[model samples]
Target: MSAQKRLVWPDVAKGISILGVVLLHIGIGVPEGESTWLYQLNTWLDPLRMPLFFVVSGYFSTKVLQFTLRDVLVKRVWFFLVPYIIWVSIELWTKNLEWQWVFGNEPLTWRELGLNLVLGHNMGWFLHALIMFNLALVAVRKLHPALAMLLSFTPILLLPLNEHIFFIGKALMYLPLFFAGVYFRQAITAFVDAVCRLNVPALMFAVITYAVGFFSRDLWNQFTGEVVLPWYLPGMDYMGSQEVLLLVRFVEQTFQLPMALVMAVAIARIPYVSSFFAFIGRNTLPVYLGHPIALTVGYHYVQIVGQWEISMDGERLVNTTWFWTFVCIILSGAGGLMLWSISKVPGIGWTVYPPSLRQLQEMVMRPPVLRSEPCRD
Candidate 1:
């Protein structure tokens, strides 16, 4: 068994990954039918995003729950469900989206809301997928990790990988990543330890994996078209869904297990980079939420500074694929820096995952000392 050791690159990688996601979201208006340089960057970075998140999430599997299923659900509620509802509602309201129009709802039932929540049918889909993914860890322990992955993976048959609602679809999609986090944690530790040794063969293997994966993706696109590219994920056309999922599992473990280990070892071996990223990793939530907000804030800032394009109501200029990419990085960094400030405050430090206003009102009303000012001499 591997003793618990901190893997620090995840912070910097997550910070980078999360920011990349924001940039990709900002890149929404770019045409999607063909291979472009922007698209390639998106794909290269895309694999890291969720897989890394599941890996980080996996590390805490035992840390979070053990005895009761209720405990698991409760923590998920506080961290995921509650935040998702709050944020999605905020997104919909701010973007002037009518919930009625978006979901085509005439009568809104809790059942429908719950379905929407699980399916990630709303704006906060990442968080939605997160809820189901974490729940999978707690639910399926009787089976071997590989068997659990296979069983959980069955939902891919019924649901398309684009994104789906059934619990199994999510379970299978992310379960492998999470399992790797927990089960192979020692493997990861060993890999990192080996990386600490820094043998030439290990580094060469890492490079080879990157090359095969990258070129395989390009080759898939060139030969089969974008539709059939990535013939080994939840949604590749060449193989059946299960077969592809199995292949993706092999590739991820083959590549990511070592990649995360080697890269993490490389980063942690460095003193300054480790310290900086670890601090950011500890404060991951704020940057995740604040990044997109900051990008828009930056876009408005640029506008005020005269570099802004005058976008007519139907025509928007701030969302070009290239420009918005930089915008997201700068804004996300700004948000991280700002969060570093708020985190310093006494008695108000929980804003990173801000509680509901109802919760806040109660906290304020029950305060021990009012905001009473002292008289100075």
Candidate 2:
């Protein structure tokens, strides 16, 4: 679809999702053993945030399914792979420097790099995982689209993969929701539309779903941490008990997805709010890439300036106040905007934000020059 003709709601949804991600990251950055209202809020919204992002990604993937495999791969390379590699390298380098400064350790080794590549570590792992997911989907769709979707669901119900593998596990965990967006596009669209119309029943359903999901999350967190699982089940000795894990998954599948969708739709229906978020949504790429750096630097700066003896282990923020959370948010937004500005530069920008596949192809396939004049000889 043309840019101007594109749907607004998805962008609004994305805008909201990215903000959620930022807030979640900020919450996580708070020192261990510290708790705040902001952190609790982030925990409540966790199930909805990333799943919503993946679903939207899958929904958009439909647009490219008709392209040749070569074209699709090329698009993925430019849009996701290139940026992922660049950003991951940058992130790792900075992290290595930080570690070295703090502990006088050696830089990351080749083995570490290889393992990270395999596991898709770092903040840019989402982009790496998205590339893999797109390629896998493309391959599966070749057999049959329905079959591809059917296969995606298997991972959701299966036992969780080792969390140490990080990105791989996350990709597996989220695959079904992503494919649901692809296969159930029409239904999702209709549902969003119905909710946007402020259908009273739909609103009520959304509110109730969100409440249940929130409550379930609280219970899950409690059980996983302090409260023991009440009943013994097979694999209770595992890192995450199977029965409790299943219940958590059930909550995600049943309540979180619908709540996220309804919230997105409701936001989209509001004229001013939708417009503001849509702007952020449209520019999420730069924000996503830049925000981590911003957060990292901002946190350190705050520590140094405030002379707060906060532990380097992320044990606690200097002051665990709502005002500090607001400051972090502002810093993140400013950092994102700075990155966006950098991405507009002519030559250097391409390093941070590669050209679109179409642009790259156009540059490669420009018209051959016509020999208009005879040879000088």
Candidate 3:
């Protein structure tokens, strides 16, 4: 397959994953209940969503990962860092603005924003994590590929550390899957293609296994009496019983990877589905960076009315999960378009593509080196 054709599925995967992210954020502060199917759906997708994105990102970073430290810093680290710094600042500013104007909540101080930018403390942490993962992989780049992969498990096994170091914690949590993508690219590609062919059984197995894992997770929580920690968002804190969380994490991770790949391939094989998602995938950067701002604006506007749901024909369905789901879809689509439009404007476009002249000069001046093999420890 041509290089461009090869990327269609990964892009499709990214498109879907990003959309999932938007949907989750759009529902923020909406109360969760058993009947909230959208909430349930988001819960179900939580595990697979980011792991898939990281893996796909890792797949594409193979050559860059092999670059020398300088090239890696310029090409990969700087690439993610520029936008991360810019957008995190914008996102924090928007949040403070909204809180000050509408919610009467204490706004984050500039010091807080500065600290968050350093610590990867916002929704933009994906970009933040990318910088670290690229650098982290550098140390093991020349280890026997298998040994390096085995070491990737180190982070997941030391999962307890996530509590004390939440910023590095999040990056470490996803690093193994990212490493899998880098080290096992060929095997993963073959698997995706094979599932695309045997899509029916593949999908069924994927769904069944995922369902089993999902439900069993709830059961495990019930069994263990797992409680949400104070500092973490629902379903995100790693401060629970270490032994049980490890088992839970392992099962979830194992099931999540296959399910993610299957879902992407399944979507890619459909007639119109593949192309549509691929288009979204191709244009994900704008949506990823802009959707939070868009959603934040929409959210506060809704808060002014003191209602989280919409009115249709003079009827308010405040508790209708489907209504919220529909609204999220509409907002996500509109937000994406709005961001895309804003990106076309001059000068202001730096919010999305904020690279310094020095960085640009470095990129242009640097010559590509043969893939470096770091000295093995």
Model 1: per-residue lDDT, tens digit, 35-130? Answer: 336656765666555666667667666554363567666555456665567545444443332334445546555576666665667545667666
Highest-scoring model, TM-score: 2
The lDDT of each candidate is 0.56, 0.70, 0.73
Ten contiguous residues with the weakest lDDT in model 3: 229-238
**Which parts of model 2 are misplaced by more than 4 Å?**
1-6, 32-34, 143-145, 156-161, 207-239, 242-247, 301-307, 310-324, 357-377
List the pairs of residues colliding in candidate 3. Answer: none
Each prediction's TM-score against the native?
0.67, 0.80, 0.79
Ranking of all predicted structures according to TM-score, beginning with the best and ending with the worst = 2, 3, 1
Task: Give the least accurate 10-residue stretch of model 2, judged by summed lDDT.
Answer: 231-240
Ranking by lDDT: 3, 2, 1
The candidate scoring highest on lDDT is: 3
Candidate 1: where are CA atoms >4 Å away?
1-7, 29-43, 97-116, 160-172, 224-257, 296-328, 334-377
**TM-score, prediction 2:** 0.80
